[model samples]
Target: MPGGTDSKSGRIGAITTGTREAGRLPVLFLHGVGSDKSVWMPQLAHFGGDRMAIAADYPGYGDSDFVEGATRADYARAMLGLLDRLEVDRVVVCGLSLGGIIALEMALFAPERIAGLVIANSFARHPEGEAIYDRSVAGARDMGMAALAKARAPMLLGKDPPEGLAEEVIEVMSAIPPEAYVLGAEAVWRADLTQHLHRIACPALVLCGSEDAVTPPQLSDELAAALPSARREDIAGAGHLSNAERAEAFNLSVDAFLSDLDEKP
Candidate 1:
């Protein structure tokens, strides 16, 4: 919504920017649960040069098509469809939280389509994901999305998060359909990509907020440790929503990593 045009009802929704260049890989963004394409505005602005940059909304989360009971695989397939529609041969996929897990699935399912990866504030899987999701689904079932958004938004930021960020996050999250919320929680809760990390052959960057309470630094440390070609960076004073809380730092770190990859022979 912020980086590109939104679909006029009934059309599939995606935020796309930059001019497509032959032989140049696009930068594709996948956002976390309760978030949509708009969250990647900072990244799109930073990366949308001559190369393609896109931030897409998952089904039921935005203007995208809704598929009840969607799995992570479904999300990955949707991404593939987006790429195909855009004539993109390959992409540098970047994802945050639930989006990050989805990125891993994309690597597992279609490794050839990905040139590089960025996993931020995410884990292979949550150890107590079952209980966490159960409570979450139940809460949504009872209180509704607005209430859930208001309740959950605070836990995702640092002691003093970026101004206006919480409100923005809540607004996006509150718009999610109940079914999609339930389905998303289940998919993330069930994900276990530990064994598959070795299969991700592309260069990867792992990021975490030093103050992140949702997915702590230890989780990112483990992911960085497991990835074959990877580096870890921590953003001080940021929390679960690191990109939003510290957009300048996050963008700089990612830009440096992508620039380094561009220099490769």
Candidate 2:
């Protein structure tokens, strides 16, 4: 694991794996809200063997410093800055939940910087987003991060879910600062990339858990239909956090997509 931190770049931190290879675009991962770079541990282990894989923490989460009133675009800028620090000109960006939204923002911000995209358990535009965002913000503010985590963690998984994984997820969520969570919630609610999806010229893989209650399969289905070069896949026995709950299936799907890209002219 090529794990390191960069505090010099204003507290933006990441967990990077794999050695850079010429002719291979690095894979950059962005985690959902309440999660940090560690959320993509499975992805790093699976993809790091053949290509560079990097997972970054959103501002104010994990080791990153708080960015007051940060929006999804702010997060995208942070990623671009991080890439600049690493001297990476192009990357295959993959993001889940809020991370996925940010990934789309990145595509919108600079389509030239992306080689491909993997958006998991996310939506181009959330219809009931205002209510959801308001509820999440108010919940965290009233109940504290830990209490909110305990209540929401169960819903994020499938019927069977995974043993002990809920606790693990809750632990991560519990650590998020209240202010960061509020801003992130607001960002998610305000996101409206529906009309802009066609502008993304890069190939995209839209993935979701078969039983995702939060973002559901329809969201991914919508994304698949909209993005110019997008495909959809659903992970069985998983929920919103498909990569963590059903890592093997998630990795295989993404790896196959990457392989296909490698074979292209």
Candidate 3:
């Protein structure tokens, strides 16, 4: 098991584990809008054994302070600021959903600082983004986080989720402040990174859960097709939250990607 050290710097908070290995870039895990750094426990434990692994909470999500009217670029800057504070030069970014958009923004802002990218269950430009933003904000405002989380948890998971998984997702989502949730939803659903995809000149692994109705596999396909150097892999029988729903498969794909990175000259 990986023991994490939780720390805060400026407006960013993160859970870090393991030690930096020479010639190997650190791995930074960014959570989706509905989750915090805690959602990455599976990944942190799996990857923290021999290399630096850090999972960050977006501003307003966990220990980090809220940023009112934060744009997608602003979120990207916040992550970069966290890296600067930690004195980490470059990293392999692994992100899901909202986290994936921020990763793209970071690459666009500072390509030299991004060693590679692992984008899962995300989109360069969502087709139903506006409607999603409207529905989500309305749900958060009306039903409240707890109720909304309870209602959506089942949809976010596969037909047969692991025991306690739905409860975990509901718990995590329920804790998010309504104001913060709205901000994150806006930042995620209102942005478009389609034209900018070709600019991210790093190795990328695009992952999609076969049962992901949220972002859908078609979105991942488009992402891989647009990115300069990227490949697509589908996690069978998994849903939107594949990282948690099918952790073993998700970690295996990530492990293989990391191994390839290590083998590079």
Candidate 4:
């Protein structure tokens, strides 16, 4: 919940964010590892102006200066800080990949304030593959961005990725300090929210790209089923970063979900 000049507790750093003021609910966008709020550009364009939607970079990513002593908890704090700054009492949150995990953490930390949620391409518990985290740290340490991107960039995109986005992803990730990116990956692999799903009281949406080999649709289904108030959707022909790869269809699903929310009266 960070903001401009008049913060009470402190600052959440120079966060990069996108906003739309006309929609019913304020929407907060959270990006995944090694990426920034810009990842949601297409969705922002689709939903902006008429929708109160926002996308923000985590402290260390994008144009924001990195916060020292950073951890996932710090990420949540920073988002809450923004909410405080914006004078928003409640919001619908949407997040993909690592961003989804942060959104979940926000719900857990402040259930009373979250109106709804859309969690995509994420998991309650990371499946097997200790080696993925280990290798991420190693590759970042030794060979730098190219090596890490070579290892990671393929699985993140669909079978046939968009024309220029691969390079775009690589460029963003390449800007990250190798050690820092490794820290983020380790945080993702170490994440565990298995016991916390039942506590999420806000209305929620769970979705995954049909082609997401990372967390997969099964994980989304599991989360949806476990939640007291959650609906799950699957997007065809998209992968881990489905929101970016197939933004239009993804936005349609999101727009429909939000539309349903608007009709609740």
Taking all chains together, each candidate's TM-score versus the true structure is 0.93, 0.95, 0.95, 0.90
TM-score between model 1 and native: 0.93
Backbone clashes in candidate 3 total: 0
Ranking by lDDT: 3, 2, 1, 4
Task: Write candidate 3's Cα lDDT for 56-161 as tens digits.
Answer: 8887888777777776777788888888877899999999999999999999999999989999999999999999999999999999999999998988988878
Better structure of 1 and 2 per lDDT? 2
TM-score, predicted candidate 4 vs. hidden true structure: 0.90
Clashing pairs in 3: none
**Residue pairs with clashing backbones, model 1:** none
Tens-place lDDT digits, model 1, residues 1-265: 2332222222346878788665556889999887888899888887787678999877777878677667888888787777777777788889999999989998898999888999999999777778888888988899999999999999999988878999999999999888988878877777899989998889999999999988898999999999999899998899998988998999888887777666344
Candidate lDDT scores, in order, read 0.84, 0.87, 0.88, 0.77
**TM-score of structure candidate 3:** 0.95
Which scores greater on TM-score, model 3 or model 4?
Answer: 3
Task: Report residue 57 deviation for candidate 4 (angstroms).
Answer: 1.2
- The global Cα lDDT (0 to 1) of model 3 is 0.88
Better of 1 and 4 by TM-score: 1
Residue 36 in candidate 4, Cα distance off native in Å:
1.0
